[model samples]
Target: MDLTVIWAFIIAFAVFAYVVMDGFDLGIGVLFPTFAVGPERDRAMNSIAPVWDGNETWLVLGGGGLFAAFPLAYAVILPATYPLIIAMLLGLVFRGVAFEYRWRDPGHRRAWDFAFSAGSLVAALAQGMTLGALLQGIRVTGRAYAGSWWDWLTPYTLLVGLGTVAGYALLGAAWLVWKLDGAGQAHARRLARGAALATLALLGLVSLYNVALRPEYAERWLTAPTLWYALPVPVVTALAGLALLRALGRDTHAQPFFLALALFALGMAGIGVTIWPNVVPPSLTIWQAAAPHRSQVFMLVGVALTLPLILAYTAWSYWVFRGKVGGDGYH
Candidate 1:
């Protein structure tokens, strides 16, 4: 068996899970200011309060997996995008503090709310820029990153950052639509409509930019052979976007959120198609970046034993917290 390939998939799954699980809550934080204060904002917070922290578990797994299973990639990628990573970490920390203190200190709730929104927005943008920086390809020499500190601060990266913000806001709006009812749901539906339009527009721009930015990506999508693998992603994504718009317009609750998730899944698939086999991109393949075979096998054993338990408990938590979140709490 190709242990390197297995580890690659494991890390990909971990990152995807982190994005899917944490994206909406971050989106909620991004859209927090738009909601009416008091009950509306409180309900939005209540909806995600139970699962938000749990969602970050996948992030730890993804980062740690990279360090252990693909040390070379970790070593190179970190230096290439250190500023963005630090920004992301700081945003998470501040938002986490704001999340807890808002409840404990009602007198300064407004300030906490601002901190939460700003932190979440910064984190989301930083994460997206980090992705863009990676996709734009890192400068590597020998076994290390040879890029300057500001290599990540390009126009293309900024566009991706904006797109990420729009995408997360859409997810947040869809989530609120799913989890709230009455006036809050109606408001969320309105927000979702705007967010949907913005997200789809940005997704198209980002896709086109991606093609123009890298010949490899363009060849993958426009040429033969790999073209077959690449074609369905955008087509299916468009269909999903249409369905999401339709769901938002109707009386449906859960469908919009799931469709939004479908869009994210398609985005991830597009990324996989773009950068397959290369963990650091441009040059380094998974096999070249991976740790020793014995180490991989050992890590796989631990993951095999622990992953199921994590999945089980995550599923159990969601099940336990199922249904709408109202003014007071879950109903």
Candidate 2:
């Protein structure tokens, strides 16, 4: 494989990691209000506390990789989706602050809880909107963003945002099903089933709408016989959704969580397949947008050294924390 192809796959994998890992944790934050105001919420928080921080490290890797390996994509994509990116950053900051302070200041736990939920909601919504806008294509004028601020505020974008929220909520519920027992698990099962159905419906709707609206995507993923292999992407996503539904009542705990993750992973796989070679669709490609060879070579050395360290600690921490969570965490 070419060097650019290798970096592209690596970057895509990093993006997938962030989406699957931080995706569930963010879902937990979004579902915070579903739990009661006291120990229930705390237990849910404890379920993710051990690994939530590392979950986001993948996002940093993705952004840094893009900036290093494909600076042009980072530049154009960011400018096109300016509002969504800013809002997402703000939401993440707010959520992180609330996560930490909620533990430190008992007096303001309730307020912190509200902040956390709102932040999670906003961030998830923004991410969904960004995906929607990106799929529809960002407006570029002479290699610069020329769209209005509200350009991304389309109905399809809003619908996709809602779908993303539902998907993340399902992931969160699945995690809870694995991490808790008894009452919490029961609550999670209910949430998981509902969110799964909702997500499936939304995913169906988004695909149908996108195929009708974006002819380029339709041509790339459906009309072309060569791309037929990518059909398994959506197929796997649908199967994962069904598996998640079936696993809710099953005795296994990890099955539901992994099944939910499988849905995310399969979907990402499909997207990567559809957009292969193109860092930004209908326009820029990986080779077209890549940084100089010298920069990629230099960055490769750093990524090679640091990426393993990140993965090692991430795996080790999860292994160490394996087992059900009971009672409030950090007590």
Model 2 over residues 219-279: C-alpha lDDT tens digits?
7667657457867777778777777778887776889888888887776776666566688
Q: Weakest 10 consecutive residues, lDDT, candidate 2?
A: 322-331
**Residue 63, model 1: Cα distance from true site in angstroms:** 0.4
Q: How high a TM-score does candidate 1 get?
A: 0.98
lDDT of each: 0.93, 0.85
Which candidate should be chosen as best, given TM-score against the real structure?
Answer: 1
Error of 2 at 316 (Å): 1.0
The C-alpha stretches of model 2 lying farther than 4 A from their native spots are: 328-331
Clashing pairs in 2: none
Over the full model, what C-alpha lDDT does candidate 2 score relative to the true structure? 0.85
TM-score of each: 0.98, 0.95
